[model samples]
Target: MSEYDKVRVGRLVLKGEKLKTKKRKHKKQGRDEEGTTVRDEDASAHGGWWKTVRIEEITGSIGIEFGNQTYVKALDNGLFTLGAPHSEGEGPAPEEILTAIKVNDTKIALKSGYGKYLRVGPDGVVTGRSDAVGAMEQWEPVFQDGKLALLGCNGCFMSVAQDDDSVVAVSKTAGKDEIMQIRSSTARENENVKELPAEEQGSLAQVEENYVRKFQKFQDKKLRINTQSRSGLQKAREEGNLHEILLDRRSKMKSDRYCK
Candidate 1:
């Protein structure tokens, strides 16, 4: 397909990525407020600890099955590969990546990984690979299968580690107010493709009509050639030069032309 055909699909993915990045940054800052940040004391950077901040993040691996024995390779950029790698890990290439992510006829497979400190859902979506919580440490909240685990703040008359997962729902946590509650991958989009705009639709229809005319003209020429061959065969039969086997062969040749 031409680059123009990809205009709509490409735009949607690009927009989604932008939103994902913004959400990630905001979450990082929120986690930071609850956790402590450590900066290296040494001026020269050769042997010093890297700046550390706590964050809650979620991650998953996707395995797409294209056809028999075909799968995609994961990349740091979150894209996948199509064909077998020329040399392991070198990459199956950009063209292959494009083919793997094609909008139609491709099936996706998802594998969820280890949970993170922050939970996106009540106990549902686990955030992975985040360091936003700092070094306070954490214990997994035992979320009863169907119970709502609200991350409320404060205690009986109380005091506790302010960085716990439960703080997410508390009204007073420094950054809890800004956490955007969003449903991941839950958008309901129209599965049926939208009809092209009238002007665009008309242009495509015109292109189709031209293709059909060209195909029809080719068929007409083939038919005319067969008609002349049949006439020649008939004349050959009537003149005393007729041979029964030759007549049968001519008929077979006409039949075989289409097959060829």
Candidate 2:
């Protein structure tokens, strides 16, 4: 049996030297009810983990926290087990952190620190030995009634084993023990914001027609757009005069009511 399989969950504790806690000086002061001044600490500085409520938000590094402060930690042998309990405001350890990739809209794949993908073996043990993600490597995070549970490809819910605390997928239905939190760092800003298309960014002929329809006063209600060679317009766009050029085109067509 592997070291992870023989290890008991209760006996596990954070290994290696303790991480030094970063201290910050609060510049702002606040008055308490007793009229005493106190330093106002930023809440964001204390914790970096944010609960991932949506599957689409499960990108980048993540920590699977369950049963108090315990997390699912990746072992060197490509196996996973319940890690040591962490204090409040403490982030997960390096081995406890895993890279999460959104496989699709409903499925995701977890890559351990060992650079292996996590998948359920035939024995239902959650192991990270696969080099590539397949159907068995894809996992679905089920969220219901404000509870989160991970559903493996084998149609079993992932949970910590009671005997050894090894991560496994065996239960067909998710219960209290299956409820877990997937947390990510708060450094991701605008991660879900997609770039707008050229037409949507008002850089295409279709966008010109849309502007004309919104602001143009046509007697026949027909949309009119400049169909001539757009080489000059493209140059104007490069020179930061595209809007002026578009307005000039509208004026020549006598279609813009705002044009004087």
Candidate 3:
């Protein structure tokens, strides 16, 4: 008898002959594809609260405030729109917050809540569909006088459509509608960290010794430093000629091998 017709009338199902069924993949609740929890607390940790007043402070996680009480928000469809206004004191919603990565001194890239890099399309519509940053994903924040605007890589200024509140980059020149503010949670005190040149970093005596150690040939293993007035050194440092003045001092001491 054919194997298909040989089934016993009773419960004689063969071992290992059961139907192979696929395990159902239940979608995770409140979690993105990357397994990150989509909660307001996670957005807050990414600097979603404070308002950034300066352009230099526009790094890390930030929000673009387009209009009064309205912020540029990312949508599930990978597009941006001006979100509904919130209370006067409340900050942007979780979807309105984005990660701003400084690509260079003049350009920055933004990543939306969906983990996609934002870019301007040929139609000037802003979309966040790229998985990684590219040339088109870069944006320049132009600050002039007391106003700020975002310039897209397409040479258009980002502006909100008055009809639909959609975020688009259509105008080459930034107008009143294009002005926007980027807010962040960075402390104001941390913005201006004092930086000094290597030669003038420490106390005056230490500054002198640092140069001496760097240039001194020390044939007899004895350090020789210029004990003359450090006023000229301080002046040179202020005038941005500290290196030349330090080299001259080492040359006068007959210590630096390269001074000759």
lDDT of candidate model 2 versus the reference: 0.82
TM-score of each: 0.15, 0.56, 0.55
- Cα lDDT of model 2 by residue, 112-187, tens digit: 9999999999999999999999998999999898889999989999999999999999999999989999888755
Tell me how far the alpha carbon of residue 172 in candidate 2 is from the true structure, in angstroms, after superposition: 0.4
Against the reference, the lDDT scores of all candidates come to 0.27, 0.82, 0.82
Q: Each candidate: RMSD to true structure?
A: 30.3, 24.2, 21.4
Candidate order (TM-score): 2, 3, 1
- Compose the digit string of candidate 3's lDDT tens values, residues 163-224: 99889999999999999878776555643544454655677678879878877888698899
**Which one is best on TM-score?**
2
Instruction: Supply candidate 3's per-residue lDDT for 83.
Output: 90
lDDT head-to-head 1 vs 3, winner: 3
Give the C-alpha miss distance for residue 222 in model 1, angstroms: 17
lDDT of 3: 0.82
